[model samples]
Target chain A: MIFIKILSILVMLFYALGSAGVFWGIPAERYKILVLGKFFTWTGFALHTLLIISIILLNGADDLSRGYFMQLLAWCILLAYFIGWRLLKSGFLSLTASPLALLLFILALKVDKVQIEMPGTLKELFIALHIGPMYTSLGLLTLAFGAALLFLHMDRKIKSKTRLTEFDRGLPALGTYDRINHLAVVFGFPLYTLGIAAGFIWAPLTWGREGGILGSWDPKEIFSVFVWFLYASTFYLRILRGWRGRKAALLILFIFGISAFSLLGVNLFMPTHHSFGSLATFTA
Target chain B: MNKHICLVGLNHRTAGVEIREAFALADAGLLENGLLPVGAHLKKDLPIKEALVLSTCNRVEILLAGREEKLEELAIRSWAAARNRQPEELAPFVYVHNDAEAVKHLFAVASSLDSMVLGEPQILGQIKDAYKDALRAGSTRFILNALLHRAFFVAKRVRSETGVASSAVSVSYAAVELAKRIFGDMPSCKAMLIGAGEMAELAATHLMNAGIKSILVANRTHERALELASRYHGLAVPFADLFAQLPEVDIVISSTGAPEAVIRAKDMAGVMRRRRNRPMFFIDIAVPRDVDPDVNTLDNIYLYDIDDLKEVVEENLTQRREEAVKALAIVEEETLNFCKWLESTELQPTIVDLIRRSEAIVREEWTRTSKRLRLSEKDTRALELMLGAIVKKINHDPINFLKNRFEEEKDGQYAGLLRLVFNLDKKELCPRRTREHGSEEAPPPLGPPDGGMIPPRRTPEPAAAFFNRIKEGSK
Candidate 1:
């Protein structure tokens, strides 16, 4: 429990430092230490997942229906942290991913940790198919964001064409980062497409036939497709036409911004059952 | 002591490409014939004591390690003879140092601080190669073994902790990267490697590796070009035919050892006509580059020399300055640790001597007392325990203090007092003074300079010692 509290505090402080632009004159060992610290945090996340499951078992199956959103988001965040941990270990994505995971964990903590028991079979399957892919997509996009930031930093440093500061050594090469960002989009697309498909399939059962298909055309779903289009365009333009370096870097960044909007943004603005309580306005 | 290091010879720095080539020994073939003179001189006149010879196009440095008195010019005279150069001719340019200064020189050399171009890491690799060659030649002696290992440690500290090895440190490599942008893939292009200087090879090697198809080695001396060209498997084009070679070459990486720009604007303007509409990349890695400055203005040609490439290298270096500061802290930490280890070596003998003397005194006194006063077995056992505790208490501080003395050589006077009290044998505790006739007339060249380690300065508090007297100033 103490370790869990410490990790939460560390994650908050680390993100706050990043947001404040406090990075400078960092040692070679700095990220090596961060990687080790992040590994311990994943362990705490596992323990937290165990605690939530115990609470869900104590509650009856009927409660699983009403309170399942919190449970879905929690498991999604936990999976996000685990995969983020792997990416950081590979040195593909680093300090940037931690902040996003930290924010999601905080969001989970805000929601009820009192998880309810299992739902009806059809409902459970639908929930798993829809929520699991969305979380997986979120994690991949987080990795893309990390790569994109490094690419921007490296590009800025090169364009300035002045003396490199300590920051240059801390950065992966511009070409290397650009390639990683491209990879994220390549990997994230299929998973997100499947999630959208699953959401549509589960749509008829929850909202019912013609009405259900109408709910499936909710703004969140529309924007998800829009994001998919943006990323697919980036991949096509880059691979087929050799649109690389800075031009390619800027495009990926544009795609990442659209993705964040669809993940946290559409959730805030769009209406229908998929919307958060604060953002429920269905005009059509 | 065997702490001093002596280095003498010519490099790309002190002498031009001509002198470097004249003294260059590129093979073991030269070691037998050219180095024979050195062996004979060592046998007839003076022993080298300990020496290692490093000959590369950039520089030829002969590092000699020995007692300061034994490692003088006379010891290094044969090393000069190996190059077939007069002792005095090389002596004026030769630099010598002892102990700490010597270690600093080795560190600087390996870390590229002493390079013609700062932060070029090629020198460290060259030094390592030289050490290996020395071992193979059986030229390494006792002092050299220690110095070589210490040199590597110092280099590791400098590189890991300093910005010495970070960023685009080498101008030549920077030239190539920038050229890559201008030419894209250069496999379809032709490159001319001007000058056969060692530094030129580094730049040319990088360019050739980057997919430049035909690499032609051109120089003032045809023989030097022939020799160098054969090694890189490039064709040796004569200096007079430079204009002819210019027509076909797309990229010209010149590190010609000329003292001035050999390729004038008139020549470049003439060559540009032949280049047609093709984009030609000319990197003048040479200090006084072969290509003229105005050649950069020529259409369809990008000309960058040492001065221009340094600007890019400097820019990248500036970005690494923060990392450099962090590295310096690491260096300081490592230096202190090494200094501690050095002092510990000094302390070990003193500590061992003190323990031996203390135990002997205890044993002698205990036997005399037990014979006369102790009658019962229980009394004898009690007496032995009492004597042992007394010895332990008495011996504790002095031994511990000697070990602590390594922390800035504190209580410099305490060592003598402890030795006197314990009656520790002087011969065993201190370094045995040896007759250093290993080489004569080669006493360490002591130059008058105040370049010793800077003692930690005291920024006096305005309160003037807070609660204590300002003894020296008041007096």
Candidate 2:
């Protein structure tokens, strides 16, 4: 466990350096820096996988526990970034997406190893249903944020009549970024809806027959619904109202910010039904 | 000693366009004819070994591989005589580069770092074209072959590793980029040319190349508009209908050379209403500004004047200059790599001689021994074949080691030591000592020299040390 913990920290440090390299590489248009960033990113990812596997083998089924859930979410975000990067071939998005993953890793590292006791009546299948799509939605939303950032950057350059920077030239056309944002929301929204629905269905059995849709008014539940609404509105404005480019990008950015806050902040500070009294305690 | 790489030429920097134009070779035929006199001079009296002529509109550079420093004057005289001019006419406008500076110049030229419009991409293609011409003239050999191929690689590295060629530096290109920003890609959008002026025509051509849906040309003179439209295979609309058709066009490039603004804000109001506020990109490249500047204030209307585009170009140029610093580093690195390969070639003759001498001794001993033993014909043939393979195997590693070590050492000092140990005749391998003796007369320029591997003596030592020292100082 100590070795795993040390490896996790090493992975985080590698990700930080990699994120910095990619951030500076795009603007400078240096292949060496970009390659270095990729090297560190891959090494970090491999080390992170080793940590996750070790934790899973040592503490069986604890992979789905709240203690390791943030780490899983960070891994999912990196997976999503890799898929998008390969499919879209947008080098500029990597500059943003890599840093976002690093930030997630840093947040995950700080997350106290709190083991939340599973409800007695809750089935193992119900936990799987809740954790899988939940992380997928978070990962997809993270990618949307990266695409939105690049779209805004390119929009700023074009609107200002400024010369395109080395980074800007490497960016996908505004159309591609807009499409990525829209598609991520379209795909992630359904998965999120299913996850929330499963959580609602599973609540009655665990918390009692009276535990329903409005059972708890926790910050996590409220903000989850709030993020869903924002994402739904983005689709509504884009498909029906014909909002695109800057407006669409800005809305997706808002959705990502709130979702990120809900994922990290609400879990840390706010009280909720999702308790972790069995694990490590908070420091400060 | 290898022939020094030399570049003697005039560019937009050193000469007027007319002088460059006069010296520019338009095609392979012109290059061949241009090199005919220079090639003959090399064969007759000049000490030049290999030659390549790179002649573009912006520059006409004569790159020569030769022994004498005085080949520039001989080349210039031949070039002048070909064009029915005098040597003095071009002397003031021309500049000369020799040895490492010449190599650097070639690299810079091929990479477009030294171009009038910094980072312009056409220069690389132009350089490749010159290389092809040299191939056709049979004037390019190993030295030029190595230098030019390395030049292409360096150019490619510079382009990929820097942002030198990324931005639009012309008004026409800016217009295309503006259209792309407004309408995703220009090919899906329709464009209108409001005037037949050169700038407007240039923009139309650029838009056509970008694959615009359709181009509509509208001018005050109907026939002129028709003629200009026909050239691009576009539709020619009447000048009166320019306002009525504005709803269909996504981009408007206007440069009428009119004294006053032709299209005002009031005219655009009706056009915008008809178009349902779809974005309209206006590029006013005229001096007096054909389109009203006030129109830019309207919704979905983006207007850029000639001044705005010039500002963009200037900014792009500045960015290219910054990128050029990195590009120069790549060029210098590649130049050093080439110099090393060239220095390694100095050991080629010595290596060849070592093999030849060993084979001769074996052959002579075998002939004397075989006669005394009265060996059968089949046995003698087999013995000779076995001995030949053994000789090749024995010599392979030493030759490979010498080649690899010389690349790292960069000077032929080690190879020279090997030559002395092998007792190889230095004169037979390289005639560098002859040029060092300073006989003060030109060597006979005929069919070919007796020693094929000996190159012209320009630099006695590899320039890799000098250049590496300079790089360290800069750092």
Candidate 3:
């Protein structure tokens, strides 16, 4: 447990340093600092991977703690960032990924651990299918949100005909941001559907047919379905209608907002089966 | 003796373009298959060992290596004579640097520090071409070959270690930079030339060289548009259909001679819808602005008139000036290093004399002793091996001292001291040959009648090559 704590702190330090490097590098226009930032991010990623493996080894595969889930979410976000960085050949994503990863890791340290209980081995398989794709898709959605925000900012700067700031100069072309948004939705929507299908299948078996297909009219399940519909419509509009640029970027931002509410607010504030523990215990 | 490296020239700062053109050696056909005219003329009257002539539109310089006393005078006379002018007429505009200064000047010139535009890259290629001409004419020998190679190395060092040439200093280049920021990938973007003006044509050339996919030319005069389009292998569109073609190009350069705005916000709104809101860049370079200022308010359109481009160019030029300061420091550091190597070459003749004297003494003693002993062939071989080892061992400390002490003392003082201590100046064991035959094999000297007892004199290699061999052997 102490070793896990130490490793988590080291991961946090590296991520914080990487964020600082990106913030300083872009404005200064020094390429070496940017490369150093990338090196730090990769180092933090390696240590974070080790931390996750150790947590799994100590607590078993069924340890579905809220803190562990946050760590995994941060890891998946970085994974999505690395993939986008390689595919698009852009370093601007680090401006978002590094600081966000550090924030999530710090949040993971503050949140209480709450392990979920499972009755059968088949349910464990279903949980993996549900959690894995769901968090990965959420990670990609987070990146899409960042790309959309940058696109709008750059779009406004160009339209305003103002002198570009150093941060604006460091941004990739507006088309590059649109491409990232396109890639995220194209891949994230399908994986999100798979995760929803797995959850729907697991619900009836776990609740003993008392609550029907969805297991109950819980806020978590209702909001999840709503978020899925929003994503599906975004994907459809992007592909069939040839929607691009400002409209596509705006829609992606809206979908990401509702998805964030479903993932966090529905589980915490509302009455839902996905709540980690009792409200009294969570607040304490 | 140290070879005197000298440079005499007139550049844009020292002479006007009329004088520079009159003194240009390229017009004299120096690049043809013959000795350089100035070099051939100097060889007839002076002791010039090596010469190279560099002639460009901005400057004409002659780099020579010979005796220091009259080398500059002789080089100026020959240079002026080749151009059918008197030496006195061109002397006032000329500047001369000998030895260390000459090396520094050449390095700075090759690094583009001395260019008209501070960090322009064309000067290095011009110097390289001049060096190649000298090599073809067989006018450059030992000293010049090393100096030119070192100058090239210094130029590369300055370029890579500094940001001197990393920014755009011209209006066309600034436009290209802005376009890159908008489109990211230039090869996928198309460009439209709205006029056949020189500025627009220059921007079109830069865009094509940047690998823009295709170009469309539109002008008020169809014949002029056709002529310009044929040069770039692009299509010529009629001026009436300019709005229809505006949506197809990602970049538009407008310099039409119009009193009013050529592209308006209302027309661009329909074009933006047709382009699906893809980004479009407009570069307006006309006295009366060609692009409407209101068009810049549209969502995906970026417009820059001539004043904006001039502002970008000014910012970049200021950055280049800062970078050039760093580059000049590198040139200074490397100049000092090359001068140290030049100083080390003066020690070569002393080292050669020391070795030859030691070998001569060893051979003289061995011949007299062997004749009285009447030794067999195997014994003779053994004695010869022992004597050769003795000569090498005896000369080792003195040679080491001379090589190491030259770096600490003033030039050639340690060499002179060693010559005095070793009694190397008492007799001239070997007669000095003219520098032109300095590398040829020396004739056999008078030794014992046995003939093979004394070894043949070693052929002299250039000092730089000889020092490199010694360094490699030590390593």
> Which numbered prediction scores highest in lDDT against the true structure?
3
The residue-by-residue lDDT of candidate 3 on A1-284, one tens digit each, is 89998999999999999999988886687778987998898899999999999999997876546677778888988998888778656667787889878877886776646655443548657656787788888878878887887888887776555556545665688888888888878999998999888877766665555757655787777888888898899998887655777788999889988987776666567876667454211110
Candidate 2 segments exceeding 4 Å error = A19-38, A87-103, A106-112, A117-129, A209-211, A275-284, B17-46, B178-187, B192-196, B216-281, B286-302, B359-475
iRMS for all predictions?
8.3, 3.4, 2.4
Name the best candidate (by DockQ).
3
Best-to-worst ranking by TM-score = 3, 2, 1
Instruction: List, in the given order, the native-contact fraction of each candidate.
Output: 0.05, 0.19, 0.38
Candidate 1 ranges beyond 4 A from true positions: A1-96, A109-121, A152-166, A173-175, A209-212, A215-217, A228-251, A278-284, B1-91, B129-144, B167-172, B175-344, B354-394, B403-475
lDDT of 1 by residue, B105-146 (tens): 565677666677666678888999988877666555544665
Better of 1 and 2 by lDDT: 2
Q: Which CAPRI level is candidate 1? A: incorrect
Q: Is candidate 2 or candidate 3 better by lDDT?
A: 3
Q: Which pairs clash (backbone N, Cα, C closer than 3 Å) in model 3? A: none
Lowest summed lDDT over 10 consecutive residues: which window, candidate 3 chain A?
A275-284
> Per-model C-alpha lDDT, please?
0.58, 0.74, 0.78
lDDT of 1 at A55: 48
TM-scores for all predictions: 0.60, 0.78, 0.78
